[model samples]
Target: MTGRRRWTTDEILGTAAELLRTSDAESFSVRKLAAALGTDSSSLYRHFRNKTELLRAVADRTLEAAMDGYRPPDGWKERLTATALRLREAFGQHPQVAAIWGRYGSGGPGSRLVMEEVLQALRASGLPDEEIPARYHRVVILVTALIASEAGVGALLPEEYEQGMEQFRVAVLGADPDRFPALSHFAREIRPLGVDRRAAFDEIIAAHLAQIEIAIP
Candidate 1:
């Protein structure tokens, strides 16, 4: 009988992160991870209680990478936007990871560290103390939604996605221009564009920052 290979916690976590980068949660399984590692499926339980816990570990590692080399910005709005952009880039690298972490604000060490940075920036800003919590909540919700949207679309490769857009255009492009002028005009501009998650993220961040400005008291 063959013996099971010993795996280090760090190695397990690293592999889990890679698995998330290449695979979505829908198809990623502990058995698949074990196969990838050339180990028994049950052995992963030594490092993680279950799939959720393992993926949470992966998400936490991603947070560290996301904020790596990060420095405090000159002003609070700059701070928020800078952090937001880094997080978006991180998601771009591992789109599936976004959905996992977004569902749970479970506050692993890396998550707590990032949140502290945000709070530090908010404190330095002149926004009223009473309004800080609500503002923070809104920022979290908006950023998470944007990341999730990006991740969902990323289930396919870029060329595969572009093909999907072409197929959709074929389905709907036959609409009479006079009857649906708005759809005809806008579909041409937007459909080929596909999911510009970063652009959508920037627009909402600007709107939210505007709200932050109004909250200053």
Candidate 2:
């Protein structure tokens, strides 16, 4: 007789996650996933009753991968920045998974754990218990907003966009010196600094967290 195969839940979720990472969520199917795993669709159904449940599983796994083993730093600001940056990196690495994460409710176990960590961090910083929820929400908003912005959606422009910026630079510097003294003086520095995008993101997150600390008290 043929031996029965055994598959752990992590194995199933990991396989689905790998597929989702490479392909769009819309194109992923249980039959295809099962085939990829050397099993049949029935086996997948046994693990996940429906596609929605499967997606939740996928999201849970993805978030766990994103947050697992992250240790907060000594300073609250640094810790907040680290958390935000890590979250951004995770989402950016798996754009498809990030899209799914943004849609789901944060009531999932992984999501709750993340919130707990944030609250604990804030409380450690001397925030009152009553204010921890609001503070946590602000941090979540900041991180999520930065993640959405960093997704690079609608930010890239055609070659003409670059040409337009150049033209604007020229027009400003070419104007009468009296009209735009600052532009004339710093025309060279006015050009894009070509800063590393990831570093710039970290700076922005750090700045935002600093601001939050001031407002929290």
lDDT of 1 by residue, 125-205 (tens): 898788878888888788888877777777578888878877888756766778988777776565443456567778889
lDDT of 2 by residue, 127-205 (tens): 7788878878877876766665554332334564577667777786686778878878877666443325578777877
* Candidate 2 lDDT score at position 18: 82
Q: Any residue pairs clashing in model 1, and if so which?
A: none
User: CA lDDT of 70 in candidate 1?
Assistant: 93
Using all chains and alpha carbons, the TM-scores for the candidates as numbered come to 0.87, 0.71
C-alpha-based local distance difference test score of model 2? 0.71
Give candidate 2's error at residue 184 in angstroms.
16
Clashes of each: 0, 0
lDDT of predicted model 1: 0.81
Instruction: Output the worst ten-in-a-row residue range by lDDT, candidate 2.
Output: 148-157
